[model samples]
Target chain A: MLIPFIFISACGADNANESEWRTLDLNNTVLLTLPQGKVVIELAPQFSPKHVEQFSSLVQKSFYDGTKFYRVIDGFVAQGGPKDGSEQDKSVPLLAMEGQFSTDGKAPFTLVQRDDLFAKKTGFKEGFAVATNNSKSGWLTHCPGVLAMARSNEADSASSHFYFVIGQAPRYLDKIMTIFGRVVYGMNHIQAIQRTTVIDGEYAVDSREHTPIISMKLMADVPKKDRIIIEVENTESASFAERLVKRRARASEFFYKKPPPVLDVCQVPIRSRLVKLQD
Target chain B: MLIPFIFISACGADNANESEWRTLDLNNTVLLTLPQGKVVIELAPQFSPKHVEQFSSLVQKSFYDGTKFYRVIDGFVAQGGPKDGSEQDKSVPLLAMEGQFSTDGKAPFTLVQRDDLFAKKTGFKEGFAVATNNSKSGWLTHCPGVLAMARSNEADSASSHFYFVIGQAPRYLDKIMTIFGRVVYGMNHIQAIQRTTVIDGEYAVDSREHTPIISMKLMADVPKKDRIIIEVENTESASFAERLVKRRARASEFFYKKPPPVLDVCQVPIRSRLVKLQD
Candidate 1:
């Protein structure tokens, strides 16, 4: 039972408290309170400005306070925000889906410099797992913990509903969905959300297992004393680059043979931590 | 509400019923009846002969009939076996870890021909995700749905406990753990297993929420009439190679631009179906 744990524990301990972690901005973050724990999401406004703006407004307005994770597919995604057939966002304008950013050589880049199967140039930019053509546009990828708007069949039908990727990185969703933010902390809480068992192709959720969102709010809306501060490893830092290399070909006592030489950007871990603010 | 669903369904429908699926061997498969549904696992003797043999013997002896999935990490693994910690295999000698296989030029190979970051060469041989150095040895990969043995800190400490990968491919565990089989069907049931909520760092599982295994039995042990036949896409078939290419650069109505021109073997869809037997 402890086999992989011991191996992972050793690999995870090296940079547990590295000083290179960059504190996130409260104004640009959202906090989701669940029965289990608190999940902090660092909003990505750089990639999808409209979607981020709408999401923050919805959060501030408490639009998602009591909504249940209506549809959760295990090894796939946990979706929420105004249950099915809900009328909470009827007045809200349907926002056009924003999936990619103009790459036209103007966007800031943190080159992962690896061959990616999903994008021509893959790396982190503005605190999001990003991929680009390296010339025209880039987009926030559908990696685990990514936050994206849930819409109907129409490309511009996205409104209040959103989902978080809680399973394998569904990269095919890239350039197709509007990824506005990502859960930075409490991934366990996201993983702990109840899963609906699919009978045939439809999933049935029991009300007893429904883990409702206690509240959703922008961190900025909360008082300074009550706000929880989080810091993420700066993707552009040299330490981050070194971490990527180490992850590609990890050589520990447990590993008699080294792993392959290539790495996908999604495999590059972005470590985050909770900390107390200095008075 | 339908954002990712619309995006995924279109991508999933193209090859839903292609005539490229290969039927699995009932003799080498195990059926795990869960509350959600029946999960069928195909044992891989070619990859980990000792582990698979031991596992089958234990299953036939009813060692895991009443065991609960004691440790389940969301987006990771569901580990289960004899929770009583009782000695079920006292008579059987503890088997040595069989993590990798001889990758010498003489070994059978099915080349994926992709630049994988985890292995020098990766492919499927005898119905398992395999990775190797191309000259020395290969091991089963930690792709989702893979079943592997669990052990202590010691490299040779594995015994009866086993786990299944239910989320993202934990490729880092490739050579560190012994992968003996893979879930050929009912993956949705595996994903629906209860998740332990980690409060702080400790996981808490509720007795009522715990999903117990109804029973475990090998398909060979059951009557032929009760057997469920599953056919997976042959990895070495021409159709599979063509599917891999289509997955890399899909250009459909949903996909405004062509996807990146690279495909991870893990991303390639291995289509499976339940076909009626020819009378």
Candidate 2:
């Protein structure tokens, strides 16, 4: 949906100016350079270490470059990777389920709510949306922009194909798909990919509609001058907590009346912005 | 975002076979015949009476005949109405804020959750998502496929433009926008509209991408022979509650592990299907 341009621009500026933010480690970041722009994704190894490792390895091997977003369901997910199954390397063993919560839950954990309807507890761990029944382990959520491995009916089938949440949080898929990362920048570019019409139950994007992945490179591989430095709001910080409260009971000038007094973690603003590295 | 075809087709069949359902009132229904197919929207006058009246009146007058979905944000909303503001008929007075809870403790209300994060109480009333702080009144929610009146910053400026939520349940818009109806049939048709790309901070759709509205007419206005009969699942039914439980702890064959133990109101399926009206 077309959000009011003013609202988005204002939010973008506010996020760019956040006082307390953490720069994403280059080793854990990947850049997807599309025709529209570059999208930077931060891999969450703490949640899905194996999936992260495999995804990064694939990136370094240039597995996804030139791949097309084969299946994009409006308000659902943008799935891209190998579609013909020709790229499947049988040697890359299929990974077991890595979707369930498995975090240390120590620092950088900002508990959003304790009584979340979707889980025993819901919060942000490190820089990703998380939900779990215990502090020992939690799964990454399916919020918009989340990167998750797509699998068939088999639990161990997730190997190459990955889908990104582009709509409402499909919490039902929380423990079913391995969420590995999130797009932190150039979401607009991703959102701008032209919709491909489905025909006779077949998801076929015409050659003209294909949004080609120009390249997928880990930040560490990019030259220092070419790398786009970014910092995400420390989700566990006090400022973030304050911001979450304000969003839940928004008293903004445009709001006719105060909205609901609570917010889902997805509704909370976890901002990311490009930053120039200090020389 | 694209969904697995098998999963979607399976869900489609399940939704189409609801045993206990309610046929939409012709007087309170509007059909949007597009290039792809027809979308049936059930108007909720009880929620926003004035907005519904105005919208239906505009439909009857053929105000939306050739309009295009001007602004469509993937995983957000699809907004469409008169763009040129030249169609404004001064006779139609501007609508006041009719967007808050206005119902009494009611029988049709199936309370989904008492501790809803978005509101004091949340549930479904007459097959539409509703939320209220008190037992006396509740407003329609911004669930997927919800039809809402859009306006500028002014609360009372809602006149012509309207939008359909095609993504996540944006609860932040709950008491803010006037949600007057919902799409009860042909959601797939609505979801099929090609997404317009955002260029230079503006929503732009190439002529090739535009999904033109062939016509929009109230069901009452359509000839009896041409009417497309459809029925939506009764939200207040016991079967719906059972379905909600199954969704929360989904043990389906596809699920690697059972997901969370709770269901958000939007997560619960409200099925709709084609039906033949007994002569």
lDDT of each: 0.75, 0.76
In model 1, state the lDDT of residue B10: 57
Q: Which ten residues in a row have the lowest lDDT in candidate 2 chain B?
A: B196-205
Query: Candidate 2 — what's its lDDT?
Result: 0.76
Deviation of model 1 at B9, angstroms: 36
Docking class of 1: incorrect
Candidate 1 lDDT over residue span A220-249, tens digit each? 898788777888887766677777766666
Cα RMSDs, all models: 10.3, 10.1
Q: In order, what DockQ does each candidate have?
A: 0.19, 0.26
Backbone clashes in candidate 1 total 6
Residue-by-residue lDDT tens digits, candidate 2, A1-279: 457887787677656434567779899999889887678899988778899999899999998898888777655678888755574544355878788754565532567777667776777876798887876777788888899998889998888888888666788798878999998876656665545544222335576677778999999999887787888888755677777777766777788666646567775646776664322
Task: State iRMS for model 2.
Answer: 6.0
Write down the TM-score of every candidate: 0.72, 0.72
Question: Best candidate, DockQ-wise?
Answer: 2
